[model samples]
Target: MVSYYHFQRMNKALPDPGSWDEYFETFLAGNVVWGSWFDHVKGWWKKKDSHPILYLFYEDMRKDPKREIRKIMEFLGKNLKEEILDKIVYNTSFDVMKRNPMTNYINEIKMNHNLSPFLRKGVVGDWKNQFTEAQNKQFNEYHEKNMADTSLDTHFRGLS
Candidate 1:
């Protein structure tokens, strides 16, 4: 949500939340530009079985890129050679993508990269650095409440 807010702010599509607490509060209230994150996920989770949805998680990809890439290949019915798969994994890595002008969005005029890069610290649990103890507790409670009805696994290893 923070990343999305930063992107929107950079594009001049949304106003700042002014403070970290306010930002989190806004998220919990579902007052974001697109809507609540949980609603978005729940909507997709509900429709996944009925639709041809290839639901993927960022943490899963980060944990095992080859496995995730293989899942994508299987979904798309693509059977590339092992060497090609290796190259694909290499090219799509966070470091490679961050450096690649085409993938990085560095040239985007609307985005203020000076404020925050489009691809900023592609790692799990970076939110730990930003969230206060109280905010984390609040967020966890909110997450539990929002996600109670769904079978979606929200756990992200060290994130919690």
Candidate 2:
């Protein structure tokens, strides 16, 4: 959510809140641009099997990008050599994307990269640094309530 906040701020697409908490409150109220995250995800999750949707988790991708890439390849019905898959993994890596203007938003006229890079610290569980204990507890409760009906697990192990 911090990343999304930064992106919106950098692009001047939304009004700035006084602090992260303010933005988070707005997010919790489902006043965000795309509506509630749980609603959006749950909607997709429901029709995923019926549609050509391929739901990919960031944690799964970060854990084994090569494996994820192979899944993507198979999903697209493409048969590429192992060497090409290796190249795809390397080119799509965080560091590579951060340096590549084409992949990063470095050249985007609306975005102010000086405020925050489009690609910040690309690590799992970075939210730990942003959320206070109180906020964390509140968020967890909110998340539990919102996600009660869905099988999606954002808190799957190995986040760190």
Highest lDDT scorer: 1
Candidate 1 lDDT, tens digit per residue, 12-131?
445765566777888889997778999999998999879998878888888999999999999999999999999999999999999998998875566777777888889787877877
TM-score for candidate 1, please give it: 0.92
- Give per-model CA RMSD: 1.7, 2.1
Residue 40 Cα positional deviation in candidate 2, in Å, after optimal superposition: 1.2
Number of clashing pairs per prediction, in order: 0, 0
TM-score of each predicted structure versus truth: 0.92, 0.91
Question: What is the C-alpha lDDT profile of model 2 across 1-160, one tens digit per residue?
Answer: 7677777677655566447888888888888887887788889888976899877878788899999999999999999999999999999998899899888877556677787788988898887788787877777888889889987777532223
**Ten contiguous residues minimizing lDDT sum, candidate 1:** 9-18
Candidate 1 lDDT at 68 equals 96
Candidate 2's C-alpha runs over 4 A off are: 156-160
Q: How accurate is candidate 1 locally (lDDT)?
A: 0.81
How big is the positional error of residue 81 in model 1, measured in Å on the Cα after superposition?
A: 0.4
C-alpha lDDT score of every prediction, in listed order? 0.81, 0.80
